[model samples]
Target: MDIYVLVGIVIFLALAFDFINGFHDTANAIATSVSTRALSPRVAIIVASIMNFVGAMLFTGVAKTIGGKVADPAKLEHGVEIVIASLLSAILWNLVTWWFGIPSSSSHALIGSLAGAVVSAEGFGGINYSGFTDIIKGLIFSPLIAFTIGFIVMWLFKQIFAKSSPHQINKGFRTGQIITAAFQSFTHGTNDAQKAMGIITFALVAANLQSTLDVPWWVKVAAASSMALGTSIGGWKIIKTMGTKIFKIEPINGFAADITSASVILTATLTKLPVSTTHVITSAILGVGSAKRFSAVKWGLAGRIVISWIITIPVTAIIAALIYRVIALFM
Candidate 1:
């Protein structure tokens, strides 16, 4: 097969994975706003879709990280095969989680797949320990940071509005929720789509389709567009989980959690860390739920989600490794 043709296939698959990531995680950004009747389902998805595209244009720091820093590309004997395996692993995992109405991290799936492919291609020597360790720091800290900030912001809002009339507080927070939700969606685009863009660009280079690290303008447009279109489809089942399962989200709590998730994700993106928007926002929601009372959170269900998070990386990694091995045997 021609190298350019092979690279093109990998890029398309990567964009497809990005599309799944956006649609699968749509519930993360708009669930509360929809549940609280701040926006109708149609309006919420349309608004989120626009913000998602705009957000994709905001930065490329994380894209650079994924394309250039995580693993040494030279070590992979079959770069195109690795690309296919990694993207397929992410896509399959995203579908599985979506089917079960659980919000898992697409970001972690890609990282794990790439790492697994690198190891399979050429032992641990292919891994960039410093870059890999930095990503690990982000994976561990992002959700914890988002949870703390969400809790504090929600608590403060409750304290300040304690004396306000319910009508006034509700109106104020309804307006605030729109702004925070938009911010979260924007952050989502900036971080999530870039991961796909990076992988596609990396594949091009690996297949000798591109001579440099720079991503083609067409790749950016396609990646961003796929994510935006996917967001428009929405994820209703997971929306129910986030909006109602965690706790009864008032407008004030919704606003706080959105702001907190936005802040953490934006900061992580600037630092070029491939962090999970799903993990960050879900952690914030759980924190808000726990703030009211421990019992307010469905601990059993939350525990299950945590277990899913724990398994995502290894499961996807093994899947990707198997994919590469199979492809090598046939191709």
Candidate 2:
């Protein structure tokens, strides 16, 4: 295929990945609020969609990191093809996980896939080790940070509100959950949606269509719009898993989890690092659930979720590597 045509396909695939990410991961933002009856599913999806678009428009630092950190697009002869393979692998993993209602990390899938594709095209020496390790560190520690903060936050809430009547507390916190959910959705936009933008920017640079990793305005708009539309659809199965299955989340618990995870996500965005909203949010829920009652948390399910997180990188890496090899055959 011509370089121009391949670049076009890469852009299309990048946007498609963003769209899937919207629904696949947006559930984490609104699940707690919906579960606690703080917001109807319809209202939650609408709010998430609008906030995601707004959030996506306000950041470009992380997009730049993704474009150049793993490998220099300017140096790779097969950079565009690598992007195509990475995107396809990521998208396939996303769909499969969403179908099973698993709350896996989209960030890890994209990062791992991109790295694997780079290695396929340019060998292990191709990776920017320092940059790649930093991204990995960000991903690995974010959930742990969220868990610790969530535990502390929820514990504080419990102490502060202990004397209050349960009914009144639930009533007030239900309203509070609405704001936290919106904030969560907004932070999600700031981070998760930008992965697609970065991939598209990477393609542009690789194709020599642009000179720098700065995201183009049209690229930002297209990625934002694609994600917002996907957010509107909502991921019902994952919502169920995140909301009702994790634990019986009351309004107070939901509020704590939402606010904690949102702050963590926004912090990562400001630092120009990509973190998995899925892992952060889910870990927050687990931490909050632990604080609520250690015995109450379904440890079995939490263990299963942790397993998925651990495997996402290696699984997506192998998939993308194989994809690049197959694509290489024709070129």
Candidate 3:
């Protein structure tokens, strides 16, 4: 394939991955608000779409980290092809998880796929151990942090509202959920939307069209637009899983979960680290549920979700390595 043609294919696939990510993770942002009747589905999707775009347009640090941190795009012999395999594999995982209504991590799929493809193409030496380990650390610790903070936040809310009427507290918190939902969606954009941008930029550098990791203007617009459009579609199945299955999310519980997850995601973005919005959001809900009443949480379902998270990296990695090997036959 001509280099230009290959690059074009990579760009297309990257944007497609971004689009899938938007809807796959959409539930992370609005499920709580919608479940609590703080915002209707239609209004929630619209607000999430707009906020996602705005947040995507405003951040590039995460993109830079993704482009260079896992593996050096410019140093590989077939970096563009590695990126193509990574995108395709990640997209496949996202779709499969979405179909099953599982709240899996698109971030994990992408990062793991990219790392696997790089290793397949260049051996273990292909990876920048320092950078890659840092990324992994961020992914590993973020959900734990979100869970802890979620517990504390919900604990505070419970104490503060103990003397108040339950109905009155819920009525007030329902209104507050709208703002937190928007912020959650915006933070989602800050982290998730950048994954595709990074993948595309990785391809550009590998193709010799760019020398630096700085994202181009057109790339930003295209990625932001793709994510916004996807967010508008909504993912009702995943929304059901996230909003209701884990536990009963009253307005106050929803508020605490949203605020906790959003803050964690935004902090990760600021540090130029990519965290799984799915994990953070779900963990926050779990933490809040525990604080509300430990037994009320469906521990069996939560255990299954955790199992999926544990396997995503290795499964996607093996899948991407196989994909790269298949592509190598043509090369």
lDDT for each of the candidates? 0.85, 0.96, 0.95
- Segments of candidate 1 deviating more than 4 angstroms: none
Off by over 4 Å in 2: none
lDDT of 2: 0.96
Better of 2 and 3 by lDDT: 2
**Residue 93 of candidate 1: its Cα lDDT?**
91
lDDT of 2 by residue, 1-331 (tens): 8889999999899999999999999899999999999999999999999999999999998899899999999999999999999999999999999999999999999999999999989999999999999999999999999999999999999999999999999999999999999999999999998999999999999999999999999999999999999999999999999999889999999999999999999999999999999999999999999999999898999999999999999999999999999999999
lDDT of 1: 0.85
lDDT of 3 by residue, 1-331 (tens): 8999999999999999989999998998999999999999999999999999999999999999999999988898999999999998999999999999999999999999999999999999999999999999999999999999999999999999899999999999999999999999999999999988998999999999999999998999999999999999899999999999999999999999999999999999999999999999999999999999999999999999999999999899999999999999998
Model 3 ranges off by over 4 Å: none
TM-score of each: 0.97, 0.99, 0.99
Taking all chains together, the TM-score of candidate 1 against the true structure is: 0.97
Count clashing residue pairs per candidate.
Answer: 0, 0, 0
- Comparing 1 and 2 on lDDT, the stronger one: 2
